[model samples]
Target chain A: MKFSVVVFPGSNCDDDAFQAVRSGLGQPVSFVWHGSEDLENADAVILPGGFSYGDYLRTGAIARFSPVMSAVKRFAAGGGLVLGICNGFQILLETGLLPGAMLCNSNLRFICRPVHLRVENASLPFTRSTRVGQVLTIPIAHAEGNYFADERTLAELQRQGRIVFRYCALGGEVTPETNPNGSIDSIAGIANEEGNVIGMMPHPERASDARLGSTDGLYIFRSLLDWFEQMRNAECGVRSQAAVPHSALRTPHSK
Target chain B: MKAKVFVALKRTVLDPQGKTILAALRDLGYADVADVRQGKFFEIGLSDGLGAEQARQQIERIARDVLTNPVIEEFSYQVEP
Candidate 1:
């Protein structure tokens, strides 16, 4: 499947995401400039990490107004898969494609390190390859990755199984110390109610290769591929059945 | 027309920067200061030809939609002719 990675003016990790998808995963991918209004024929879109618009005003406040974002919003509304990482996650929240907002790290410091993420909901397209309660080591780098939502919103997210990943200890224990960003309930990643859009503060692309220290992040990309295959198979099944003529079936001539 | 927009974190949300500032103030011997919360202030100049009510509504919309994120922050605005 073809993938498109968005490149905002201040996007620094665009190359990393491109390399991960194009080289590491052997997928057809292209870069889409933030100024461009079209996403071409990409099946999925990736908003890579970076301080878009120099993180002025807010981390993603300005980047959300970029010309490409309107197209991204439309792509997401059409049920196309969209993944946002780090600053991209911030942009998703700013665009209202996802709920909640990011706050300064509770410690008021930038955190950059490998953290353990528990797969809270493995049924989503992004984590379907992993098992629930599985732990993956992913690197998180950001100053405002602390996710916040009101009580009602948080409750709704939890009830809907939208919380896809959560910070946890290496042994799968959830604790305050394991949460690097002081995010509420240690939430590291979440998917929309429809499970078509996902946003996470951790950089899965940064950990896609074993040479990068760990390859656990590869599961996320692989899961996407698996989901695509499933969808295609389902579509083909419907099409083949529809191609059978009703008159031929009555004569028992249809195979 | 000119407008001043004030953006502040919601009361329920934790303000790490404001907490740090409050601690610094207490450490500097400002014992009487009960609390401190930090916020953002923006000065916007609008073009002429708008009525008072219209200007007020415009500023309110800007403050609510652009100047502040409703998820974790609240905003207020004042317009001047």
Candidate 2:
């Protein structure tokens, strides 16, 4: 499936994501400028990590209003696949594509280290390559990766199993110290109820390369490919369900 | 017209930066400091004809879409009339 990565003004990881999917997987990929309106026939749209607008007004704050975000929002609304990593996750939060927000890391520093993330929902396109509880080592480089949702929303998310990833220690439960960021319930990633869009604070693309000492993130890319391919086939087939919007799939209370 | 938007993390959500600042304040002998919550401030200068309501709406739009993460932070603003 064709893929496109968005490049915001200060986006620094678009190249890495492009290389990982295009060169690493030998797949067709292109970069779409933040001001562009085209999705370029891409089956998947990824907002790669990096400080967009220098993370000045809040990590994803300024980037969310970029010209391209409106298009991305439209695409996601149309049930197209979307993934936001790190600062991209912040952007998704800003765009309201994904609910919730990120806060300063618990340590109050730019944490740049390998963190152990446990897969909680392998059934989703973002984590299908691994089983629930599978441990993946990926690096998180950000000052604000801590996730927070209100008590009622948190309960709803828990009840819905929307919680997808959690910071965990090797062979241990996710705890305060093990939670790299002060994410509630150690949340690292979450998907909208429909699961077409995902936002995660960890850089899965960074870990997709085996030479990076961890190929754990490759499964995510593979899962995304499989998901898009399936959706493409479904669209061509007799299924009238392909065009439903993600916003329509949100909780009835959500506007 | 201009407005300074102050966005701060919710009390329920931990604020490491604010906490660090609080710690520094307490350590530096500011004993009366009750609490500290780190936040962001944005100075938005609008058109000359911008009314307070119009400006608030515009600023809130930016806040919802950018200036603040609604899940964790709440934003307030003051107008410079």
Candidate 3:
């Protein structure tokens, strides 16, 4: 399967995302410039993390009005896989691709550290390879990681099991101390109502290779490749299925 | 004419920077210092016909969607003619 990583003017993590995908999934990938009007023939799209436009006029605010975002929005609407990491998550929220908004970190600092996160709902296409409460060590680098949703929407997220990832401790519960960003209910990542679009705060690409430190991120990218393969064999199209009725999503990369 | 729009987070909303400043003031021996709230100011150039009422509604749109987050910040706009 092929992937496209979006690179905005201030995006510093596109190259890292490309390397992670190539090494983790052993697949073809390319960096799509933010000014590009098309996403090319990519099965999945990744909005990498960075302070685009130097975070002018609010982080992700100007980027949401970028030319490429319109295409990105269309891709996600067409059921194509879309993933936003860290600042990319902020962009997704600004674009309204994902439900909810991100405010400044509770402590109002740019947090950069490895944090534990649990797989809250593995039934989605993104987390199908894990069990609920499955913890993975991933690094989060952002100043706006505090996710906020109204009471009703938050409850709906809890009810639908769309709340995909929650901040956790290495071997303990996620209390206020463990919740570095003070996100409501410690939400680290979440999927849209359709589940194909996922916006997460942690940098999975940073954790994909063991040589780098942890291989926990390998599962999520591997899961995307598996999903593409499944679709190739089933209907031979470029759309993703939101529902994955299985536990521990894993399918060997059928090159 | 020129109109300046000042949008600020309400007092009830939490302002980390303002809190830090307030704390520093307390430690500096300023005992009577009250609360502090941070905000953003914009200078918008409007035509002569754009009065305060019309500008207020438009400024509110920018506040809710761009200038501030309604969930945490309450946006109040004042148009200086």
The per-residue C-alpha lDDT of model 1 at residue A219 equals 91
Candidate 1: residue A95 lDDT (0-100)? 95
Displacement of residue A249 (Cα, Å) in model 2 is 34
Write model 2 residue lDDT over B1-81, tens digit each, in one string.
Answer: 988888887777777777888999999999999899877778988998989898888888977656666677788888776
Candidate 3 residues A129-201, lDDT tens each? Answer: 7777789998999998988887787999999888999988887477787898879889999999999999999
- Every candidate's fraction of true contacts kept comes to 0.82, 1.00, 0.41
Better of 2 and 3 by DockQ: 2
lDDT of 2 by residue, A1-255 (tens): 667889887888888888778656556777888878887776789999988989876787888778889889888888888989898888998888887777677787889999998888889987776799988888999988878788887888788888898999987478888887788899989998888899988887888777888878788898886676566667788544453221211111111
Model 3 segments more than 4 A misplaced? A236-255, B10-13, B48-58
Residue pairs whose backbone atoms clash in candidate 3: A128-A249, A129-A249
Per-residue C-alpha lDDT of model 1 across residues A1-255, encoded as one tens digit per residue:
778889888998888887787767777777888988888677889999999999988889998999999999999999999999999999999999999999999999999999999999999888999999999999999999999999999999999999999999999999998999889999999999899999999999999888999888889888997787778769777523232111110111111
Global CA lDDT of candidate 3, please?
Answer: 0.81
Count of clashing residue pairs in every prediction: 0, 0, 2
Error of 2 at A67 (Å): 2.2
What TM-scores do the predictions have? 0.93, 0.87, 0.88
| Runs off by more than 4 Å, candidate 1 | A238-255
